[model samples]
Structure formats: structure tokens, C-alpha cells
Target: MEVRRATVDDIDVMAHVLATVAEEGTLGTEPPVDLEVRGQRFRELIEGQGPSAMWVLEDGGRVLGNASVSETRTSGVLTLGMAILAEARGRGGGRRLLEAILEHARSQGAHKVELEAWTDNARAIALYVSTGFEVEGLRRNHYRRRDGSLRSTLLMAVLLDTSEPEPA
Candidate 1:
């Protein structure tokens, strides 16, 4: 598998990947993903219309997943999100995409990278932990799912700013 920076041309496939992953309920987004809207949003990201960067994972020239990082409301902090088609999981695709996002974060002078994952998502949590992310907190029953049921998420973050603080 190959991980590379995304372009506008990748929006469709990226949307498809997102929708496919969403169907499994592993991701925050629910099924029935609106591809057109997602395509537009991805187009904006790929066009550099925001303080964000996106990357795609491909195998045999077909996109199998995507990862993205966007500047958070807090300066120097970036919010992270990623998804891989179920078929692509456990093949190092998630790791490669994560490596790309982390490298981008450091290069962009980010201080922290943060993400939220379902509390039950052990595989995802393990991946994050092995990659230097730590559980910061848990949001109890934070999300109301489409089924009218509530679910919790674990907040995780990795600090990238290891420099000494300035003198007071």
C-alpha cells in the first residue's frame, strides 16, 4: 500500500471510502453518507481552502482509505481523523496514514494532534497508543447515535512540542 498527499481528483474515492467505513459504525459518521457534500468538503481541503491537509492510502492504484488533520480552535493544535476500508485494516494502511499525518503535523509546526475514538474501538485505540498518543479523557455518553442510543468516546492526544518554555 502507498500513502500520498491527496488532490481534488481524489475526492470521489475518498468519499466512497468514508461512506464504506461509516457503514460499519466504527467511525463517527453514520451510514448513508452524502457523497456530494463530502466531495465538496474534500475538494476544499485538497484545494488548500482551509488549514488542513489530507492523504490517501492506495493499493494497486485504487484508494482504500484516507486520513486528515485540521487546525483546531486552539492555536498550534490539530484535530485528527482517519478511516480505512475494513478490507484494508491490519495491513499497515492505518499506520502508514498515521505516519503521514504525524509528519505533516510536525512539519507544519503543530504543538499537538488530537482525536476521538469510540470507547469500544480497541483496535483503533491500540494503534493510537502504539503511535505515541495517550488517552486524555473520556466523554461519557457524548454522542447520540442515529438509533437514539448514546455512545462514549475516548479523547486521545500526542504532544509534539518538546521544546523548552520561554523565560517569564
Candidate 2:
């Protein structure tokens, strides 16, 4: 598979993949995220007014999954978000997407990249950990379910610096 920067044409596929994964329930918990809202948000992020960046996994002329990074100099940080199609999980697509995002972040001179994942999502947490992101902290009950229950989240980060070697 090839990984590349995503163009506006990828919005619909990315949104569908993201919504499918978000609904699959990660780690040991499932959280409620408005799929329709997320689809719209994905569109906005790509065609959004603010600065944003994204990458996609391609094979057979399709965008199977995606990852994104957004930076704010005022915040001194680059935030990441990603999702692979449910059927594509267990493949290396997510990793490739993330690696491309890291390369882009480094190109932009970001100091660090961080993301939030549901605490119960062990697979994602493991992926982040192996990719050089460490668990920085936790937010208890950060996500509320549709019925009003709560789910916690783990904050993860990877520091980017000239002093460190890049991940292979």
C-alpha cells in the first residue's frame, strides 16, 4: 500500500472509515461520537477555514484510511487524529498513515504531537506506544455516551526534536 497526503477528494471515504471504526468500540469500551457530525467535521477539516493537514492510505484507487495533524504555534503543539476502515484493521495501514503524519509534522517544525484515545482502546494505545508516543495522562470520563454514561480517555504524546532519531 502507498501512503500519501490526502486531497479534497478523500473526504467521503475518510469520513466513512472514521465513522465505522468509531462505532466498533475500541480497547474494552465503546464511546458515542456523532457519526454524522464527524463526517461533517472531516469535510470541514479538509476544506476547513483553519490550517490543517491530512494523509491517506491508497490501494486499488481508494482511500482506505486516514490520519491528520493540526498545529497551532500559540499552543506550541501539533494534534493528531486517525482511523482505518474496520475491515482494514490488523494491517499496517494505520502505521503508514501515522508515519506520514510524523514526517509532515517534522517538516512543519513541530515540537511535539499528541492525541486522545479512549482508555479502553488497548489496540490504539498499543499502536501509539509502539510508535513512540507515551501515555502522558488520563482524563476520567472524558466521553459521554448517548445515554449519558461516561468513558475515560488516555492522553498520548510523542516529542519531536532535532536531538532524537526518527522511528523506522
Candidate 3:
């Protein structure tokens, strides 16, 4: 699979990937919406041109996952989110995406990257920890699953050390 910066042309397939995972109730906090609507929203994100970047994993002309980091109102802090298709999980796609996001954030001068994972998502939590993220805290009952059960969320972050001199 190839991971690269996402463009507006990728919105449709990326939306489908996200919608599928959202339906599985694992990748997003919001309920799954219509595929076309999601695509439109993704288009807006691409055109918004804010302090954010998005990347996608593609293979054989199909998008398998996407990652994004959007700057929050808080200075020097960015919020990260990523999702890989169920079929693509457990094969390092998530890791690659997170690493790319972190690298991009550092280049953009972000001081820290933060994300929230469902407390029950052990795989994702472990991945974050392995990638140098620390669990900052937990938000009790922060998410409601499709089955109407509430789930807690773990707040995790990694601080970037940007003090080193740039290469000449």
C-alpha cells in the first residue's frame, strides 16, 4: 500500500472507507451518515485550507484508510484522527498513518499532537502507547455506542521536541 497526501480527488473513496468503519462502530464518534454527505464534508475540509493536513493509504486504486491532524484553537496543539478499513487493520496501516501525521505536525511547527480513543479499544490504545503517546487522562462516558452503551475515552498526547537546529 502507498501512503501519500490526500487531495480532493480522493474524497469519495475516503468517505466510503470512513463510512464503512463508522457503521462498524469503531472509527468515529458520530453516527454513520449518507456516503454522499460525508464526501461533501470531506471536500469542504480539503478546501478549507486551515492548519491541517490529510493523508490516505491507497492500493490498487482503492483507498484503504485516512489520517488527519487539525489544529485546535489552543495554540501549538493539534488534534489527530485516523481510521483504517477493517480489512486493513493489524497490518501496520495505523502505525504508518500515525507516524506520518506526527511528522507532518512537527514540520508544521506543532508543539503537541493529541487524540482520543475509546477506552475499550485496546488495540488502538496500545498502538498509541507504542508510538510514544502518553495517556493524559480519561473522559468518563464520553462516547455512546450504536448499541446505546456509553464508553469512556482515553486522552492521549505526544509532545514534539522541536529545539534541535535544522539541517543546513
Which runs of model 3 end up more than 4 angstroms from their true locations? 145-147, 162-168
- Worst-scoring 10-residue span by lDDT in model 1: 42-51
lDDT of 3 by residue, 24-60 (tens): 6666546556878877767765676666778998778
Global Cα lDDT for candidate 1: 0.92
User: Which is the winner by lDDT between candidate 2 and candidate 3?
Assistant: 3
Candidate 2: residue 155 Cα off by (Å): 0.5
Give each prediction's root-mean-square deviation over alpha carbons: 2.1, 4.8, 4.5
Q: Backbone collision count in every prediction?
A: 0, 4, 0
- The most accurate candidate by lDDT is 1
Q: Give the alpha carbon lDDT tens digit for every residue of 41-129 in model 2.
A: 66666775444677888788887888887764445478888877776677888788888878877777777898888887888888889
Q: What TM-score goes with each of the models?
A: 0.94, 0.81, 0.87
Candidate 3 weakest lDDT stretch, 10 residues = 24-33
Q: Per-residue alpha-carbon lDDT of model 1 for 98-140, expressed as tens digits? A: 9999998888888899999999999999999999999999999
Q: Residue 15 in model 3: shift from native, Å?
A: 0.8
Q: Give the poorly placed runs of model 1, Cα more than 4 Å off.
A: 49-51, 164-168
> What C-alpha lDDT do the candidate models reach, one value each?
0.92, 0.76, 0.83
